[model samples]
Target chain A: MSSFAPPVQRLITELGRLPGIGGRTAQRLAFHLLRASEEDALALAEAIKEVKARIGLCEVCFNLSDGPRCRICSDERRDAGLVCVVEEPSDIIPIERTHEFHGRYHVLGGALSPIDGIDPEDLRIAELYTRVTPPADAPQDEHPTPIREVVLATNPTTTGEATALHIAAHLREQAPQVTVTRLASGLPVGADLEYADELTLGRALSGRRALS
Target chain B: MSSFAPPVQRLITELGRLPGIGGRTAQRLAFHLLRASEEDALALAEAIKEVKARIGLCEVCFNLSDGPRCRICSDERRDAGLVCVVEEPSDIIPIERTHEFHGRYHVLGGALSPIDGIDPEDLRIAELYTRVTPPADAPQDEHPTPIREVVLATNPTTTGEATALHIAAHLREQAPQVTVTRLASGLPVGADLEYADELTLGRALSGRRALS
Candidate 1:
């Protein structure tokens, strides 16, 4: 049997499952939690429980929410006609941090990865299509807003690019009026974005040759 | 108001409070938990609760335990006469992994730091003395095991060295029969044991001069 008690071992194991956290890091984190005040430790537990119990996906945008719709989708100030599509809910944060996008967002849950068995159908592609093209027999009291622009703000990775292309092709056939665009590919403001290959960088550089 | 819902934001804040987790990492972890299966997420929560509820400290060694005494102290095989002193309970794991020491441990909670207001009284120094020299009135049926060797296994930091020296001096005056030995100062098996400073390297070099 392991030297550590069952409960302590379990905590360590659970912590190690997190991204970037190794076994040693997990042990350190567990010990830190143990040394912390009961109130502080329990607060973290309560926070995890509360988030799981209360927060869910926004019905319209698939962003994290406490109710049927996320705060972004419910806000009257955000432009409904200009939708920025992203791969994951976490992707939206950096965009928001930039304060460059005033439009609404469509979270795809994840990008298309054929190797990982993720496809167009696996994403929120159908939902996005519906948003761009509403039914003709919609309620008279609530007029549906026609999406003018669908910025494919997915990650610059191969999967992200493939997802954007797949959705763009579908939108063109499904709704001809909507304009689709991808985030500019170039050296990031700071460093790398997703794990976009070096060849993609060459293309990005070629595209940006005249700008500099 | 923040863009994220209250519960989501609260979880991110709580996650950020952990030792190496920054705001971005916390947000990622919080979202990963949100995306994880309810079973997986709740298991982590349950583990945290269980550890706090069940685990306490080893009465003799101060290591983490489920009952009055830790497993090491209760074990019949481990020698009580030879105790390895460490700064924290977490430090015991590495020594155990090495399989070099079969003795019991005494966790001092932390190394002495006068600048941080930590003194001899702040640590379990007096308790170490008591363990080394038991009461004469102890029953013959319950014979106290006299500690022969005290290994100063504290980290090789400035504070750790100072703490070791302080304990060694006290042991010299109080229990001259007991031998107090600090861990050998040398190059680590692998580089980078939490940024070993220049002075520690210098000490290691001086100690290794004859052999090299």
Candidate 2:
């Protein structure tokens, strides 16, 4: 009704919803798609649908996966006794790229932000304890080996800190024989791990500290 | 192989195919979707498919439309004597928002870019000329009113300027009785009308001048 034909308006609206795409950019993008070949426009659409339908959460580590477990979780080379806990699946990539830590991962799904109502109960913290200290028989496997160390790689943000503390405390109680560590302190405080440079994340992983 | 899971990499490669979304941003957005709620992620996928499936070019004006004729072209109340010609459908939105031009529109689809191999034949120029010189029986019920003026609202870019000039020359030769005018010069040179502030665009519109 605001002058644009409904179809034109709808394309713009959807494009604007994407991150960093503004109204003007969205309009430009919509027009570009309109002007492009039908095959190209349909290609973008198919890509979006294919990614959503085919990809899923890794059963063991909760990372994005196309099958039963993420590539890292399925790999025989990664250390079974070492698992790094982080806030989101995206955080796992930079660490994995470094090739510095040949260990598995545990995606918490999100961090502990009480104000945001994200408590330990909301995250996969209980799952971490369960994975590290399995109840003798997990029904799926004989026994989840007594994990030797769990490096808390959650972002250095406020919520990340709280989640790390909660995990550190819980792991100490549940898996007393296991060591719980936090990624090193040099990460720019309050920044998300996704934005950190490879060198910094690598250093943090290599120089991790034991939780007191 | 390069640190990303195959599906994640595939999704990133596909997302990078969009205009403006690059490799790093594609990776970031792909991961964002991985963590996003299934409904929200699928909504984005559905929106992409829906827009492409439902929208098509308006046969009358060549603008994006849900039906045969564009909404503006189909409207009975529009001033048929006044037709605004623009390089793209997105241009229609700003002019429509002004409320100053009650005229319908003809989207040229693109400008005359000889360097890019886009010529008058590639655009809706012939159709515009035909619109200017109406059908023989067009006004059998009412007094025949030849199109009074064509407001060329193409962007201020080099190609846009050339396109406007080309159309003006054609209209002068084909429809001698019709007056041709380009949207005014106050529009910033080399800038797109889509990004022009409404006030500036409206002013340029109100102060439009006849092309010699």
Candidate 3:
């Protein structure tokens, strides 16, 4: 029989289910919670419950939100005409941190992976197309600023690349007026050339610019 | 302002309070929980709440328990006369895993650290004394078997060493009939002599047993 009580064992099992958490780490976390004050322990439980109860996908872009729309989508200052498409809601954080993109975002939910059974239909691709190209019967006054540009900010992986190309091709056929662009893939900033991979080096050479 | 919604941010903050969980890890965990099914997320929250509500300190040894006494304390098969003293209840796990100890345990909560202001009074030292040496008026018939041996199994750190010596001196004066011993400190099994520290090497030589 296990040394710990049933409740402790249950807590350990639950914690072990989290991403990257091993059995030893789960035990350590359980003991920490046990040592923590009742208020502190309850606060963690309340936070988990609250996040699940309140947070939902944004109606417009499918990013995580507490209400019908995400904070970025609700903000009047952000440019709705320009949208950055990413694989997941978490990807938006890094782009926002840079302060370079003043436009809004559309979360694809996940990238396309045929081997894993994830396809364009499985993601929010259809929803994205609807946002980019509204029906002709819709009032133009309501959407005064038409979608001008779409920047594909998906990851540099094979599936991410495939998804971006697929979306770009679809947008070209459906909404020819909108410009579709992919994030530049080249050598990472401040990286040593000796350690740079062949693929990244090849891209850097092709995308090289003349410094005037 | 943070990119995440208020509830998402709150969950991240709460998860960050756990030991070894940094800001990035907390954010990852929060996002994972957000993506998880309601049943899975709520199960974790419920488990945390249940552990806190149901588990408490064992009345006898101060180990974590769901009832008045710990499992080891309640087990009639365990040796009542032989007690293994440890700094924390967590320490008992490894010893139990070894299957070398059939005796009950006494959890001291923590070792004496003068620098950290942790003294004997702060721990369960008084309770241990009571268990070892009952009052003179206590009926002999009620206690069928008197405590015969105490194994000090605290860590080999400076504070642990000091606490063990302090307890050993006290027990010697209080109960001359009881045999007080300490866990041996030497080179660990399967450890290389060349890699061993000077102090540990010296202890191994001094405490070396005669070959059979």
lDDT of 2 by residue, B4-107 (tens): 66667877887787788888788888877766677777666666666677778788778788777778877878987888998878788888877899987888
RMSD of each: 3.5, 6.3, 1.5
Task: DockQ each candidate and list the results.
Answer: 0.73, 0.46, 0.88
Per-model TM-score on C-alpha atoms? 0.91, 0.83, 0.97
Evaluated at residue A164, the lDDT of candidate 3 is 97
Give the alpha carbon lDDT tens digit for every residue of A56-152 in model 3: 9999899999999999988889999999999999999989999999998999999999999999899999988988988788787656667899999
lDDT of 1: 0.87
Of candidate 2 chain B, the 10-residue stretch with the lowest lDDT total is: B137-146
lDDT of 3 at B31: 93
- The predicted structure with the larger TM-score, 2 or 3, is 3
Off by over 4 Å in 2: A139-145, A187-212, B1-5, B135-145, B187-212
TM-score of 2: 0.83
Model 2 local distance difference test score: 0.80
Return the lDDT, model 1, position B71.
93
Is model 3 an incorrect, acceptable, medium or high docking prediction?
high
List runs of model 3 lying over 4 Å from the truth: A139-144, B138-144
TM-score of chain A of 3: 0.96
In model 1, which runs have C-alpha deviations exceeding 4 angstroms? A141-143, A190-212, B139-143, B190-212
